[model samples]
Target: MEALVAITIGTLTAVGLYLTLRLRSFPVILGLTMLSYAVNVFLFASGRLVQNQAPIIGSGETYADPLPQALVLTAIVISFGMTAVIMIMAIGGFLESGHDRVNMAASDPADADQDDAEEGWA
Candidate 1:
């Protein structure tokens, strides 16, 4: 069970990092989302993996730590908000630039004038 969780976290982190390095906005967003999921899972797993265990302390039986659960919950909310903000920013950037690429070409004034002349605009 622990091994499975570890593998899941590793896979998520690897995929997230891979997508984060992409030159497009959509994939970068996905990568960040994946990274957040990985973090949430890791935080949740830190509490405990035991079944039928309550989170309350001072009990006779084994109790799981509630801190991790709370942390995971908070992380989920934060990640959601973060994703939404990034999405809005990406949309705005796309609308302004007509593309969602991260690596935009350097628009020098000289180059613009040369292109305009070539196109018979000037």
Candidate 2:
């Protein structure tokens, strides 16, 4: 069970990093979301992975820690807001530049030339 969780966290982190390195803004946003998911999972797992356990402490029964769960919830909210802000920024950038690329140099040379022409720079 622990191994599975570990593998999942690893996979999420790796995929998130790969996507974050993409040239497009959308993929970068998705990658950030994935990274947040990985962090939430890792934080939740830190509390406990017990099955059939109560969330509250009892006299003789094991209880799952609730703090990490709460933290994950808070993290979810924060990440959602962060994603919204990033998306807005991305849209604004696209509107201003006529491209959704994350980097100017990553755009095709032909497209760059076209943009330059459109801006009366040619």
TM-score against truth, every candidate: 0.83, 0.82
lDDT by residue (tens digit), candidate 1, 3-117: 9999999999999999999999999999999999999999988876877777888774788888999898899999999999999999998897678887756673322344555
Clashing pairs in 2: none
Q: What does candidate 2's lDDT look like per residue over 38-83, in tens digits?
A: 9999999999798777688883478888899899999999999999
The ten-residue window of minimal lDDT in model 2 covers 106-115
The segments of candidate 2 whose C-alpha lies over 4 angstroms from its true place after superposition are: 106-122
For candidate 2, give the lDDT.
0.88
Give the runs in model 1 whose Cα sits over 4 Å from its true position: 107-122
